[model samples]
Target: RMSTISSAINLPTIYALSTPPGQRSAIALIRVTGTQSKYIYHKLTGKEKNPVPRKAMYRNLYMPGSNILLDSTIVLYFKAPHSFTGEDIIELHCHGGRAVTSAILNSIQALNDMENGIDIRYAGPGEFSRRSFQNDKFDLTELESINQLIDSETELQRRCALSSFNGENKVMFQNWRQTLIENMAPLTAIVDFGEEIEIEGMESILNNIKRDVLKLKKEVQSFIERIEKSSILQNGIRISLLGKPNAGKSSLINSLTNNDVSIVSSIPGTTRDSIDAPIDINGYKVIITDTAGLREQSDDIIENLGIERAIEKSKRSDICLFVLEADSSMKIDESLNKLLLSKELQDKKVILVVNKEDLIINKDELRTMIHNLNNEMKNQYPILPISCLNQCGISDLIDLLTKEFKELSDTSDGADPIIMSQRVKDILINDVIFGLNSFIDCLDSDIDIVLATENLNLAIEGIGKITGQVVGIEEVLDVVFANFCVGK
Candidate 1:
C-alpha cells in the first residue's frame, strides 16, 4: 500500500513583503509561513538551535549558500499551530532600502533550490489571509471586515469595520444559530422517538418552538432594516448635479471637490458622461457626480445616452442639486418642471441651487424669482444661491448637504452591526428570510413537525454559511479575498 503524505508537510512555504512597496520606507516587513519557516530562519540568521518563539531578536541575515550579507534585521519567530496560518512563521523586519528588500527576497527563493523537500514561493494576493481563514484564524465575516478596515476612509466606515473585525457580530450570529439548533431539539425528539416514547407535553413544546422561531425571525427582519438604513455610511452619500446645459454644474462640482474634476467650457454638452468626484463633507464621505446637462431634446446619440444616464443617476442619488442660472430668463421650463415633480424624485431630496449669484445684481429680484418658481410648482423646494466663479456660498451649500446627511443617519441604529458585504445581505434576505418564512408557514393548524424542523434547519444553515461554520469554504474564498492586497 502506498503511504499518503500529510497535507501539512506537502503544503508549500509562502513568503512576501508585508509592507507597502515604495521607493524607500522606514522599515520593510517580510513574512514567511509554513513547514520550512524555521529552516529558512536558521539559514538567514546562522543559528544552530531554534530561537525562542514569539521573541524578537536582532540578527545578521545572510544568503543561503553564499556569505552575502542581506541585512542586519529584526526577526520574530512563531511556532507551528500557534501563529497565524497555524504554521511555523518568521517575520523579517528589514531596512526599507530597495536593494535590501530585494536581496532578502532573493535569498529566500534560493532556499527552495536546496534539497529540503519543502517548496518556498512568493505569496499571491490575499494568500496569507486565505491561509489564515483555512487555519481557523478568522471566519468569513471577520475576513470581509478585515478588508473593509483596510479600505475604510471615513469615521463611520472605520467604526463599522472594527465592530465586525472585533467579532461582536460573530458572537451574536453564533448565539442565534445556537438558539435555532436548541429549538430544533424538540422537533428532532418528535421525529426520532415520537412513536417509541409517548412524549408528553409535546403540544406545549411545539408551541414554544414556534414562538421562539417567530421571535428570531422578527429580530432578523428588524436587523436587516437597520443595515439597509445605515448602508449610506458604508457606501458614501451620493449627490447628483442636475440642470440645463451651461448652468454651471461643472463649475460647482469643481469647487466642491477643490479640484477641476469635470471639464468647464463655454460650450454646451461638453460633459458627455457622468464624472464622479469623491469628497469629504463634515467627516462623511460624499461622492458628488457631475452629470451631462439635461435638455428637452438632443440630436446627438451620445448626448442623448448621457442625458438618459444623468436622469438614472439622479434617481439613485441621495440628494439632487437642481442647478439653475441666476439670469432672469432662467425660469424652470415645462421639461424641468416635469422632472422636478416626477415620481422618480418623490422620495429624493432636491435643492434648487441657483448658480452664478454674482450676476444677480438685485438680491430682491433673485429672491422674488425663487419665490415665484416655488409657488408655480405648488411645492416649495429648498433653494440656495451660489457663485462658483467667485467661490461664494460654497460653505453654505456644504452646510445644507451636511444637514441632509444628518437626517439620513438618524434613521439607523448605531448599536446594530453595520453589514458592508452584499454577500451577507443576500444570504440573510434570500436564504435566511426564506427559511424563516417557510418555517412559520409550516406552523399552521396541521403543524407538519417534519417540514417546520427542516425549514428551521435551513435558517440555521444560512447563518452558518455567513460565518463559514457549516458550508464548504472554497466557494466563497475567491469573492471574499478578491479585494485584498498581496501579502495582506
Candidate 2:
C-alpha cells in the first residue's frame, strides 16, 4: 500500500507555468519535469535536432500534429540527476501574453494526449517542490524557505527566507544530528558487547553527551523564540487605534495611509467596525486598524456590538494607540482602564496619543493631562501629542513605531535560523525534544544499555525528520507542502 501511494505521487511527467498569470509582459516561464522532457521539447518545437544541455536556444513553438506556429520562445533543457527534481527538465521562456502563453500550454497538452496519452498533466500546488523534495534535491527546510521567499513582502522576511533556502538551518540540524549519533555510539557499543569491550573514559563521554544535549535544547528554544518574534516582522505588526467617540482615530488612519481608508466624521460611532490598512513605514509593514470608538451607552444595537469589537481588537493588537482629544476631557474611562489593565492586554504595548494638539489652548494643561494618565497607568507609557487634522507630529509617531518594530522583530544579526512553519515547530517540540529528554533520562538514571541505545536512536530519527533525512509521515509532508503555490 505504501509503495502504491508513493508511486502514485511520483507521476511520470508534470508541467506548470512557473510565472504568474496576467496580461502581456516581457516574459513568462513554463517548466516541465520528467524523463521524457527532451522528447516533449522536440515535439513541441518541431525540431528534429537535440539542443545542447544547459544551453538556451531560440525556437518556434508549433501546434501538436500541425505546422502552425504558436509563438517564438527561448528554451533550455536540463538532463537527469543534475536538474531540479533530479529529472530531465525543460523550461520554455515565451513572450508573456495571455494568448501566446495559453496557446503554448495548450499545445503541450495536446502533444501529451497524442503521444503519452495521460502521462503528462498539469502540476498541482507545490508538486514541483514536492518532486524536488522526493528526489533529494533539497530538504524540507529548503522547501519551506522557497515557499517563504515567494510569500515574502518585506526585506527582513526575504533575507531570512533566502538564508534558510541556502541550507543554513539544514547544516545546523545536520551537525547536531551527527554529534548525537557520535555520542550514542559508545552506549550502543556497550550494549552490544558487554564489559569485555573495556570502554575508556565512559563517565567523561556521558558527561560530554549530556552537556551537548543541554546546549542543543537551549539552541532549539532560542530558535523557537526568534521565529515567534520574526513572524511579527513577516506578517505586518498590528496596531489598533482605540479611543472614545470622535477621538480622531479615523483621521489618524487616513493621514497615516494617505487616503480615506476609513470614514471621518464629527459624529460619534462613524466607524462601526475595524478597518485595517497596511502601510510601509520606513520599509517596515505596519497594519494600522481604525477601530470603532468605545462608549458606555449606545441606544443602537450595532453601536454596542461595535464597541465590543473595538475592545476585542485592542486586546489582540500588538500596540494600542489610545487617542484622547487634548482640547476636550483627557480622562480614561473606567471601562477603558479595565480593558487596558486586564491580564489579556497587560503585555501589549500601549502608546498614549493625545490628538488635536493644535487646538490645545494651554500646553501645560496638556502635559498635566498626559502626566495624570501616566500616573493612573502606573507605568511610563510613551505619550505622543499629535494633530491628526493638521498632520502635526506625524513624523515622530512614525519614527516611534519603526523603532518599536525593529526592537521586536529584527533578527538579521542572530546566528540561529528561524523555524517558520508550525508543523516544524511541533516536530521539534514533540518529537525532537521528547527524544532528547528520553535519551537524557536514560543517561542520568543509568538505565539499561539497550534502553539507552534505543532512546538515542529515537533522538537521531527525530533530528532526521527536521532535515528530511528521514521522510516523515504522509500527513506531515502534506501540511508542509500545502502552503506552496502550484508553480513552485
Candidate 3:
C-alpha cells in the first residue's frame, strides 16, 4: 500500500545520467522521472507534444520562463508505472561535454528551487534502486540483488549474487517459511482453540510439528552455513604461506601466476614482507600471499614493519599455508615451529605443504615423517608433496583451499542466513532472534499473550529490512545510505 503511494509520487522531477561519469561517448543522456517530470520537460522543451516512450525525437531544449536555447537534443518520455521508479521519466540526448551537462543541470536546479526544493539532488548512490523498492516495484531480496551485482568482483560472488537476485534465496526461503507456517497450524491450534485436549491427538500434533521443524531447520541451517563459509572465500579466500626462509615460497607464487611477482632466491629471508596476488581458484577468487619466511631477526625498521604486516595478514587470513622443504629432514627449529603450532593460529586453515619434491633425495622418508607428525598432532592436517619449480601439487592445494572455504558457509550447521553486515546480523541474532525465542514461549501460553504479538510486531521491524516490507512507512528517513564498494 505504501509502495502504491510512493509510486504515485511521480518522482515528478527526478533526474540522473543513464551512464557513468567521464565516459568518452559521442552523446550523453540525462534522465528525469516524476509527476513534475513533464513540467521540467515542457519548461525546457518549449513544445506541447513530446516523443513517445522508447522513440527518439529531435527537438531543441529550452530554458524555463525563457525562450533561450539550452541544447538541440533528442528526447524520449516514458509514461507512469511502466518505467523505472514507476513514474513519468524522460531522457535527453545531449552533447557529451561537462560544461553543457552542468549548465542544463544548474538551469533545472534554479527553476526547481523556485517552487520549493530542488526537484532532484544527485540521486544518492543506489537511490534509484532504493526508490524502486520504496515504490514496491521490487522486494528486499531484489534490493540486495542490486547490491550484490554491484559488489560482485569474482565468479563465486557473481554466482551468489546472480542466484539470489534471480530469486533463488527468496523462493527457497519463502517456500520453507510457508511450509513451516502450514505445519504450525496443527500444533498451534491446540493453544489457539483447544477445549480439553485429548492425549493421542496432542501427541500426533506435537510429533508432526517436531518433524516438520527439524526438516525445515536442517534446510535453513545448511543454506545459511554454505553462504557463510563461502561468503569470505567467495569474495576472495585469503591463503597465507608461512615457512622458514627459502622454502620455495616465492617460487610457488610465481609458478601459480606464471609471473615473477616475487623475487626467488636461495638466500635466507629473501622476502621480508608479504606479497599477494589474486588468482581464480576453483572458479572462486583466492588471494594467495607469500609471507616473509619466519625467522629470528631484529634490525631494520622497514623489514620489521613487513614482518608485522605478514603476521597480521596471517592472523586474519581464512587459511594458512605451512610450507616445509621436502629435502630438509632435520627437525623444525623448536621455537619458530612452536609459534606456528600454537593454539592461537592452529586448529583450522593450516596445512603442511612439503615443497621442492625435485630436490628431495628420499621422498619416502619425508612422507613417513610427515605422516607420523600428523598422527602425533591429531589434526586434519593434509601433507601435500610438491615441487614449486615444477608447479606440481599447486592445483591440489587450491582445490583444498576452495573446498574448505566453501564448507565455511555450512548452511547445514543451522546459522540463520550468514548475515554479512555486522549491524544487520547483530540486530537479527542479538536483538530480533532473541525476541523470537521469547515469543515462542507465548505460543504455548494461555494469557492475553500481548507480549508475543508485540515480539512478532518487533520482528517485523528487522525482517522488514530483509524483505524491505516497512522501508518508508513505519520507519522515518532513518536509512543511512551506504557507500560500500566492491572488492574491498
Question: lDDT scores for all predictions?
Answer: 0.77, 0.73, 0.58
lDDT of 3 at 59: 81
Clashing pairs in 1: none
Per residue, candidate 1 scores C-alpha lDDT tens digits across 1-488 of: 01112356777899999888766988999999988899899898888889789898999999886687889999998887898777788999999978899999988988885365869999888888877777777887898888888777666677778988999878978988999999988788898885566789987887888788888888889878767877786666888877656777767777876632222221233233335535566656676654433332222322233445556777889898877889887676666666676677878888888899899889999889878777666456888889999988888888888778766765333363375588888889888889989988887746777888888888998888788777555666777778788877
Question: Roughly what TM-score does model 2 have, to 2 decimal places?
Answer: 0.81
lDDT by residue for model 3 (1-488), tens: 54345435534355666655556667878877666777777778877765577677788887777888888888888887777666777778888777667667766666676357445544555556555656767665665655666655555556656666676666654565456456545545554665464545665565555465456546645544555565664346677776656676667766665532222221233232335445655545566654433333222212233445445657777777767777655344444345455565664577778788777667688677667556655445677887888777877776666567656545234332232333344445554455455455564564224554455445445545555545354342234235422110
Query: What shift in Å separates residue 271 of candidate 2 from its native position after superposition?
Result: 16
Model 1 vs truth, CA RMSD: 5.9
Q: In candidate 2, residue 150 scores what lDDT? A: 79
Best by lDDT: 1
Report the backbone clash tally of model 3: 21
Order of candidate numbers by lDDT, starting with the best: 1, 2, 3
**Candidate 3 at residue 411, lDDT?**
27
Q: What is residue 311's positional error in candidate 3, in angstroms?
A: 8.8
* C-alpha RMSD by candidate, in order: 5.9, 5.9, 7.3
